[model samples]
Target: MNARREGDAAVQSYRRAQQRLRDGGKDVSSEQRLIRIEDALDALLDGLVKQREQIGSGVAVDVAGHTLAARARSRR
Candidate 1:
């Protein structure tokens, strides 16, 4: 799917997650909320990555990999 469509889906997913935490009788705690946010963000990232791949845009992935390798080498 296109980036806009993927983004829309991610937004919908985020709303659903928020609703789950806010629904009546829900027992989600602050820590769980944070985890949910992280999970949502990861899902959004994955969607974005897929969109980039579909569009044949590899610059972002290449740049991320280069930065990651540089950071890893610096730590070694």
Candidate 2:
């Protein structure tokens, strides 16, 4: 599957796991595990955002290159 979809799925799974832990009880161990999962999820989301921004910037660069080439051709 695509990167966006895969990331979404992972986020959903982590959220469900967190919810289950919360519903179970206030056990210290479970809370600690939940915190770790949350931290991981945050890192994964940040990475995905960075990837998307990079992809967008790359596309922008490609468009700018094409525009510049076209301008140069028009001047010739």
Candidate 3:
């Protein structure tokens, strides 16, 4: 998906996760919430990368590597 759509999805996911926490919802466990949050973060980062590319920015971001590192840190 394009940056805009991806960003929108990420925003929605983030809101959902936050709402769950605020409402004290127990349908999803902490681990599941962490995964959802990570997924949303990845999507947001992907959108940023795409936006940079579209704007012809000289900067480059390794989304996959960053995400891998984050996941590793989370597991530790």
Candidate 4:
């Protein structure tokens, strides 16, 4: 799958994990799932942050080439 598809899947996974935890998913398995998802999503956030920093430093580093930051320049 493409980056966008993977991002959407990550979001869905996060929501499901959050809901499960909020719904009293306190068992060991549920916590394990939550931790795994969080770790993955945290890495996703790190990548996005790095991209933002690159853009700020006058570097065009939008790997997928369709991010909001990539389009921000054209809309001006």
Candidate 3 structure quality by residue, lDDT tens digits, 1-76: 3545545655665565555445535697888877766766665566565555544322223566688899999999
User: Local error of candidate 3 at 23, Å?
Assistant: 15
Give the Cα lDDT of each candidate. 0.63, 0.64, 0.58, 0.55
In model 1, the runs with Cα more than 4 Å from the true position are 1-26, 57-76
lDDT of each residue in 1-76, candidate 2, tens digit only: 2545555655665565555445534555766777766766676666566557556666777898999999999999
What lDDT, from 0 to 1, does candidate 1 have?
Answer: 0.63
Q: For this target, which candidate reaches the highest TM-score against the unseen true structure?
A: 2
Residues 1-76 of candidate 1: C-alpha lDDT, one tens digit per residue: 3445655665666566566445444477777877767776666566566555544435555677899999999999
Q: Tens digit of lDDT per residue, candidate 4, span 5-40?
A: 445555665565555445534465866877766766
TM-score of each: 0.42, 0.61, 0.42, 0.37
Which candidate should be chosen as best, given lDDT against the real structure?
2
Ranking by TM-score: 2, 1, 3, 4
| TM-score of candidate 4 to 2 decimals | 0.37
Give candidate 1's TM-score.
0.42
**What is the number of backbone collisions in each predicted candidate, taken in the order shown?**
0, 0, 0, 0
The model with the greater TM-score, 2 or 4, is 2
> Alpha-carbon error at 50 in model 3, in Å?
0.2
What residue runs in model 3 are displaced by over 4 Å at the alpha carbon?
1-26, 57-76
